[model samples]
Target chain A: MTPLLDIAELAKRFEVGNKRLLYAVDEVTFAIGRGETVGLVGESGCGKSTLVRLINRLLDPTSGSIRLAGTELADMRARAFAGNANRARIQMVFQDAGDSLNPRYTAADAIADPIRRLKKMSGASLKSRVEALADMTGLPRELLSRFPHQLSGGQKARVGIARAIAVEPELLILDEPTAALDVSVQVVILKLLQQLKRELGMSYLFVSHDLNVVRLLCDRVLVMYLGKIVESGPAAELFADPRHPYTRALISAIPQADPDKRVGRLRLSGEPRSPIDPDPTVCRFYGRCPRGEPRCSAEMPVLRTVASARQAACHFA
Target chain B: MTAVPALAVEDLSVEFRTRSGTVKVLDHVGFSVDKGETVALVGESGSGKSVTAFAVMGILDPAGRVTSGRALFGGADLLALSEHDLAEQRGRELSMIFQNPRTALNPIRKVGQQIADVLVRHGGATRPDAPRAAVEMLKRVRIPDPERRVEAYPFELSGGMCQRIMIAIALACRPALLIADEPTTGLDVTTQAVIMDLIGELAHESGMATIFITHDLALAAEYCDRIVVMHAGHIVEAAPARELFAHPRHPYSAKLLAATPGETVSLAELASIPGGLPDLRRPDLPACRYSDRCERRLDDCARPLPHRVIGERHTVSCWNPL
Candidate 1:
């Protein structure tokens, strides 16, 4: 069966001063099946956010194709894409509800704005649909009258989710949805997303730097570093046995609650190499990798199968 | 371990006078930190974690006031001190590392000058020694090329570097207590690990008592010697780090643990605490703020709350505590 979303050889580049070009996201390729939740994990400046923006068409990719339901959208003009019926089929829930939501808009108005703009619903029918969505997200009916400033963090997040789902999209992209919330509140939001996915049969592209959160929610995981995907695998398998040096370092860096279990940690040294006109032959993890060898600069390793259900872009792995 | 705590707060309360009404952000909140110890203040937003820090640091907003409390630091009543005394005591006796390093540091000022300002103002360094002392402080915080970087502005440095500058400023005077409010909130996890390690190492070298305020349970569990769980302005539970996770007594505390994404639980299995924190401005609130959300509510919960002593150091403020 064809995947619900298929991305092929996606790349985005920006020209900096001195005529140097920077590859923010190098050639990447991945696919998401219907009702599947694929997690993209990386540190800051690893191109995770850029990758998402490219997929969502918030920013156009420099090259490559973004196929949604076998429809190519990479090269489409912004205006033409907006009018496409497929626009409502893809929706995004931004990272922080507080930051993403406009302070001037009330909770009810925020949710209704998207539905009316995209679907052009109005009058009493729009009001009823907005109320139904509020009920679905477990938001208090009375809160529909409140502004963004009056709601709690969880309530604001509910409004964000409610607004995103009001159009009944086929795919939802969540960008660190719970990073701004406390653990207790984060749990409820995660559970709500899980239930919604089950009920609506919508696929998810969850982006986060947190390993623990990805472990709980994602079916598969993709680990990126320095604008490249270094590893991809089943979430459980990757957590159990991280083959890539970067993934190993990331997993070890997580501070375990059980102090006894936290042994020596592999602190990756040095900052990421400059992305501007990087050497094509050099591995991205060369300098910072503890297992770096002289051969690392000779040729860049590509992602290859290391286990039955896992792949790592490391020569040794 | 020391028999007595280095900093102790009892019956602490704070309120903010807003247009709507006086919002009681904190009520009867209390905790302590031993010298050379790390204590985490964990709670959601408006749960009074940061407000408690601000109150202790004498930095509460103009509209907010410490209504009642005793914060005893070296037998000094921090709450009752005058603004003049608090000013003198701030960086010398106690200091804080504010969250969001990007905005905390002055954008146009040289990083070195900023650090030097703290030394001259609080460390009593002579004019000639202040610059050298600032450079040395930067080196201590592990900033590379300290001399050149010191001349750069806050905008030139990375998030981690700016945070190191903040730490350099906070520790330049070697205060007895350090209050860090979400110090590593926005930085990458790896950077967070390094920043936390640096703070822990410095506190150990100076034997500085630390009050780490954050909402991330895993991070708090990783570093804190003790953990205090707050909800709706009240400290619902306090216990040793291990004991708190192993056997949480307060229903809120247990729910917080259950909510955390750990090695044991999948995201789907993690349960969020039901309902939201009670509105502090409400004229009528339950004796126990969590009573409405808690699944284990009891008949006695409606009455005045009770502090149940479960162990030597563990305490729970619920009538139906686990």
Candidate 2:
């Protein structure tokens, strides 16, 4: 079966000053099937943002191919891609709806702007479509006249979701959609997203640092270290039996409410290596990883599979 | 076999004078953190968790005021102290680590100077020794290449590094009590664990008490020795970590446990606490703030609530507790 999105040998690098070249993302590859939800989990500066930007064509990849619905996107020009109808069918919802939504724009206008830009929506038809999207997302009709600042965090999140689905997109990239919300409200938003995905048959590229939320939402998970994909597999399988040492450390760090069931505490020692001018010979997780070996410093390990759809980059694995 | 509490708060009622009217944010709220103990003040947003911290720290905004309360810290009423006395107490006897490390640390100042400032003010270090002590603190918090990082600005460091710098500054004086208000909210789960471990270890070493304020019940359960669950400006439950999870007496506490996602169960079993916190400004507020949303609310819930002891080191404030 053809995948909805596929990435191969993706790498992105940026030059900082005259002396250093920052490797923002390095040799990452993954695919998302239709209606599948894949979570990209990592700490800050792990290149998850760079990978998403590369896939979305917001930033040009240094070298790689991003096939969205079978079309290679790396070769396209910015304006050409923006004008492409397929671009409208793939949308993104960013972190913090309050920050992303324009304070001056009302809920209706915020949702309508994307539709008007992409679908050429206008007049009464545009108004009706905006209301329909709001209704679908369970947003109150009374909130249409309120600005972003006037709405609550959950309501603002709904406005953001309503806007993303206004075009009936086949793919949605949600970047920590529930990170800023309260836990109770977070549950409601997650349920809404899950329902929408089922109803619309859309694939999701979910990005977050919260492992529990990722576990709850994604079918598969990708673990990233300093600008590299350290591990990837089915969420349940990888979490239950993490092949990579770094993945195991991450899983163990999650604090469970039940104090009786204490997981062994593993604090990752030392800081992560700098992204700029990284040593090509050294592994990304070498210095901080608890299980690092002497050979880890000499050769960079490649992603090797331990089971079906499960890959981890480690000498021990 | 418990020593006297380092800080004991009683009938601590705080209100904010709003343009609309006087909003009773905290009503007769009280808790205590014994010496060398870790107490987690857990609650949702707008549940007066951070407000209580700010009130204790004497950092409440101008719009807010403590109407009535007694906060006895080190045998002196913190509420009765003048602004000057409270200023002297800060950074020496009491200190706090805020939520966002990026914003908490001074952007223009070098990380070393920030830590040194605390050392000079509270640790009584000479100017010459301040820099070295600052680097030592940095190393203590497990930041790599402490000497180099000391000279670097906050922006130059990663989020986790910035957080460590914040922790270094907070622990520089080794205060008797430390208030960490959502210290790891913005950090990754891995980094959060590391930071919490560092704080816990240092606090234990110094025999210092800590009041950890967070919305994540799972995190609090892991790090805290005793858990104090707050709801709508009131402490709903206080229990030992193991006992609270095993047999949660408060309805809110039970709901919170069920809401937290775990490795053992599917998402379908997770249940969220329904409804928002009651507006404090409303005139028609219930005597029990959680009564409106609680599933097991009784007729007596409308009356003034009192703490009911269930077991050793366990107390809950609910008329119809689970």
Top-lDDT candidate index: 1
Docking class of 2: medium
lDDT of 2 by residue, A1-317 (tens): 77999898999999899968899998788899999999999888899998887777788888988888898888876557777877776788989999999988999999999889899979999999999988999898989999998998899999999999998888899999999987778888888899999999999999998788899999999999988899999999998889998898888889876655565756788778889999988999988888778899999999989789899999888
* lDDT, model 1, position B211: 94
Worst 10 residues of 1 chain B by lDDT: B264-273
Off by over 4 Å in 2: none
Q: Against the true structure, whose TM-score is highest?
A: 2
Q: Each candidate's iRMS in angstroms? A: 1.3, 1.6
Q: Predicted chain A of model 1: TM-score relative to the true chain A?
A: 0.97
Residue lDDT tens for model 1, B1-322: 4457889999999999999988999998888999999999998787899999999988899999888889999888899999898899898989999999989999989999999999999998988898899899989999978889889999888888899999999999999999999999888888888899899999999899999998887889889899999999999999998888899999888888888888878665677777787888888988899899989998988998888778978998988777
Q: lDDT by residue for model 1 over A1-317, one digit each (tens)?
A: 88989999899898898989889999998899999999999888889999998888778888889999999989886567777777888899999999999899999999999888889999999999999999989999999999999998899999999999999988899999988887878888888899999999999999987889899899999999988999999999998888998998899878788988788677766678888888989999999899889889999999888988688999999
Q: Model 2 has how many clashing residue pairs?
A: 0
Runs of candidate 1 with Cα error greater than 4 angstroms are none
Task: For each candidate, report its DockQ versus the true two-chain complex.
Answer: 0.71, 0.68
